[model samples]
Target: MLDANLKQQLQGLLTNLREPIELVSSLGDDAKSVELASLLDDIAALSDKVSVTRADDDARRPSFLIRRASDAQVAVRFAGIPMGHEFTSLVLALLQVGGHPPKVAPEVLEQVAALDGDYHFETYFSLSCQNCPDIVQALNLMSVVNPRITHTAIDGGLFQAEVEDRKIMAVPTIFLNGETFGQGRMELEQILAKLDSGAEAKAAEKIAAKDAFDVLVVGGGPAGAAAAIYAARKGIRVGLAAERFGGQVLDTMGIENFISVQHTEGPKLVAQLEQHVKDYDVDIMNLQRAEKLIPAKTEGGLHEVKLASGASLKARTVILSTGARWRQLGVPGEDEYRNKGVAYCPHCDGPLYKGKRVAVIGGGNSGVEAAIDLAGLVAHVTLIEFDSELRADAVLQRKLASLPNVKIITSALTTEVLGDGEKVMGLSYKDRNKDELHQIELEGVFVQIGLVPNTEWLKDSVTLSRHGEIEVDHRGETSQAGIFAAGDCTTVPYKQIVIAMGEGSKAALSAFDYMIRLPADVEAEAA
Candidate 1:
């Protein structure tokens, strides 16, 4: 229950859009109806500025709350409040909106060409947190799997007033046909139940729950995708869900070293892998980030993959191939100038700094590699190292020294990033010895000091290293039963792409081994 004071505050907060206009229009001494008209206009404008652009004008009509396809009878979902822990909930909501039955089997997708149905789902979320990427991916997957399930996203922070009016509390809250369906992380079975009960609310919401699958891959990265292709060839039901269809590879600019592929770009490699998986009956879900892992209760019990979108999935086995993200400097201006001037992963955004002065922060291999790489493209490269000595390999150290334009500043630290509104123009630095301070003007700054794994969201659900990387055994098994961790986020010594892929495969097989001992009715209970 909301406190009275909080409720009044909420009322005031909500008034930012509608009631204020009515109050102002009242000065004209018009009838109540006239003031109501003014309020309606305000609501219309607010909705337009924040809601997803529908495919057609009629598609967004107020009467057409839920759009159903003739074949895939799925409920279109729109998550309006998605943020923080709610990011995973948004994915679950998308699954429900698409009318997918819990625990989808490979044979199920192959037999059904189109999942046509009409259902409407609305979700709310915030954009400030990095975890929201998973929710965005889940919604995207729903749209792709079943065209009937159109998705509309609402910015919770941008439209705080509107969200308050809707009485939204938790993020990733889903409302089906104007009624609260569920909150927090939801599973496929729970979502189907909501649809089953929402029919009288004016949408043709029906639950066509499918049979459970043999293997359910939770990520669509190089590791996850590779695993799916391998499993599918073996005639296993493999479903791939990821924040983006390409995983971390999407942000990568080039991939010169991938075997069997010569001089290929990152996106191109992802496209090829994606196409290969598409050729099979694999259920590939893009933009779906798994929030939680519900391990099988009995032998042969299907695993449950819940998303922030309020959608849930059931699988016999789970593979976590969710890759790591580029580390941030955690500096004040780094957040503000993220895409503007501050960047991570030299391979991703290094080209933007070409012919421009840039500073690479860190002395490790990444920092040294970035400095050497940027020296060829940028006018100058300033490598700042806090440590008295470089930590990179000696061979790379010589290569870095060979670059005439690259300057190494040891025993120095970045105090702050200096920049204007448009872009980063320069930065301030201080000597670790506290003897000197200097400022340098540069167009861009790349932080390669280190990487922070994406396992913080997993919390104590799995084993994490002291540095937060997931702890995996030789076979990629974590401390927790039936769960596995892999990639740069894991305790693997080498943070190489090949290594991450290998660990991912190991984790998949481990999950498969765990699943085979579960009960057959696990999907029904999980749903």
Candidate 2:
């Protein structure tokens, strides 16, 4: 029996599907097969079809896509590729197709539904991660009310070339317009703000009003700083724009895995990175958002970047080196226990929990990897997962199984984080299979579930995969001319810091090539 939350989530997924979808199954005549056939029959009956008859292709057209629906008709989504956690997405897609109004409050929906212009959405995801479902569904819901908005979900695994070209290193990235607005699973209000024409237009105007630079780089994490350093080294007048100076890397305790750095704290590493960029001539715009991007008017011209403060920068080229961030459990006590003993990054904070009992939430590669890593340092490691089976690669699963101190608790939902004033102490959970409740005494919890890309601001500007990941060429050229993106924001394969730095360098070089080839007048003015 499925839980109510799971059932509702599944039903909402069915509504996301576009119309005229039929279930085709190959059946065999056997007792077990007959039972399966009966269930399939019932499912077929449950599917709702959105009709669109074509007058021109009345005889030869495929029934799946007929005529476009009129203004008031509900848009249905197509559900396919049901695998692992993605199976949940398949259900949500059906819900979108069925035209279910979002669970968002009426006032919020009304505010969002009032939009009239086009919204182009692209999301990038790696199937190996487990959090892409929520991000994908949120975008699907945004598309339901705003018919002008079209969404595309691109799988980084299948489209390696595209992902590498875009410099994507994480899963569940969303891009609004031509800039990054937010990363990971965003709230409805955040999406709405990006979708709002008047608000975004004003934000864009403010961004365009800022001083100009030869190059503008967004994100101040490793990737952004790396891009800034490289660009400055080339003798270009570069400006780094970031809401926060260190980005997500500052939240970490320590980073020991970054190559060449034997042992270092996350904040220390980010400080060094920031100093390196500042050492050069790169101008840093801390605590500022890259609200929007406007392509130069002339051929091979400079680009204009708008910031949240109504300041804009004119640059010969732009490099996006925004990196990925860890996803949160969002359960009770999670927010309260953050830093007081809860963390999202194991690679950065695993060592801090050494000699202590810790719980790893998630069952995929990251989860398994964290558990395996923690097992070597921590006194005890309990792996909690909502699913019954581990979805990591076989090799990783074997390694996890080999660990003696690691206990795998499958089909468990962590409902509460039990902690004391200064730090964590224990946790409460329930098994999905049975009604039995359980508790685990632990000092720390590492959320290794997945990552979300920081690319929500680029929705209306470029062609993104359905998951809001920027689409780039092998050299990191976005769909829009004179604009480029890289690092974890693009569809890159690995989310490692090393990989992000490498891709950031690549994007900088690509942007350099673009800047060098630009018309002398535009280049000179920006320079």
Candidate 3:
């Protein structure tokens, strides 16, 4: 059932539809057919221009053929139920088909229209993945702008066989012509560049050669970007390698505690970070991950950093700033309901559940904080913790206690996320003390257990904590000489953006100090 608030928003969005849309469905006996039919009917009732039709063909049973009433060619086809965050994609698609064009740059549209060969893009995604929508929308808009390109957004859970055949382990995995093209949140320009030239294969093939720099910064998060900028300011050759530039910040939604601007979103902040780094002369390498770190043979020797792309880079000094990722709840229906109702980020997807009930899984500072933050936006918040008592600080616990709409349940182990095939509706848990099972009817679940640092690759080269985080000193210097570490990936206690940036600056300065004191022979060679 659509809430009054969501219904009103949908009404306003669909009110200006310029053309009639036909939702063709062939799922006669499928369970999802009823949900899809009901949703389409609701949408149709909102506007005089929207309608639904039953298709006789069984081959396209579960597919949605969204097109203009007067046009013979289908504008778009949704293969599965577009619920959860994907609901927004359906709305955008309808708007585009109803005479609204996407806000893509004109130059990008020109490049897209000039493409010749047939390009079929299949993007597999989970509803919970915050990064998937942008990639899906970009490719979808490309399909709308050029007839030569056709794209399909597939829900990974619904199509397990295809996901297995492709060996997809992550969300936002893009397949071009049945082969893996790219993965994770990518820019349209990067996608076009890869297609224009077989860059992916080329990158793998040209790895024997090594690129050298004075300072090498790993990870592309706040810490890495800060380190790169600091190093660049020293007028030395600096290199940055990142799997994705924004790190975990890309999945964040509303950041009220970042200081200064009061409030900003994750993607928006990442754009500023990227632009700030680009403003400097740093050698930025995106979509590249560090696989191994090899120490130099002699003092002040060039250390080698191997990449997953088979390429290697040499640097006199290195700073490790690879950040951490959110931990997941390994419960049943959790993966299936991801994005539909199972979310890991409250700030990013909290507004979607306005006036609806949701759950926060965890009793730590992050979980309690999420509960307190969500209470203002959501109708009700149920915080479930596995421990008997909340582990958050006293201050946060007090804040959470003051919230009337928030309920904290301790010693409860979440067993599964309860959901229909299309969306999450509730969750089940087991009471540890009573040995009884319980259920809570809710629309969304936010998992705030903790974070896992990205330091698996550095375990062999640097001293690591028992939890797999890199070990570093007060000056950001790691166990190894000429190597420093910072950010959430290190032994640093805090994981805030400001702290990471300050540590990054300190690490870059330490690297500079090491460089200046190098042996005269090594100094000459570096010069």
Q: For each candidate, C-alpha RMSD in Å?
A: 16.4, 21.1, 8.8
Model 1: residue 302 alpha-carbon error in angstroms: 3.6
Q: Write the per-residue lDDT of candidate 1 for residues 328-400, one digit (tens) a residue.
A: 7666677767656776656534544557799999999879988988888789999999899899999999999
The stretch of ten residues in a row with the least summed lDDT in candidate 1 is: 18-27
Residue 253 miss distance in model 2 (angstroms): 5.6
| Highest TM-score against the true fold, candidate | 3
lDDT of 2 by residue, 1-527 (tens): 34466555554555554544433333344453344344334444444553322223212111111112333233323222234444555455544445444556676666757878877677655443444555666666667666676555555444456544654434555656655545454445556666664655554565555566767898888778878888888997888888766676665544768998898765567768977887899877665677787777765666776677677777777887666677777788888777567866554345445577999999997788888877987899999988989888899999999988989999898888888755688889998889788889998888877777777777776777875677888888888776778777787676667777777787788887887887788666555
Considering lDDT, which of the candidate structures 2 and 3 is the better prediction for this target?
Answer: 3
TM-scores of all candidate predictions against the true structure: 0.57, 0.50, 0.66
Off by over 4 Å in 3: 1-133, 140-147, 150-184, 189-197, 205-210, 330-341, 347-358, 372-381, 391-406, 415-430, 434-444, 525-527
Clashes of 2: 78
| Clashing residue pairs in candidate 3 (N, C-alpha, C atoms within 3 angstroms) | 127-339, 128-338, 128-339
Ranking by lDDT: 3, 2, 1
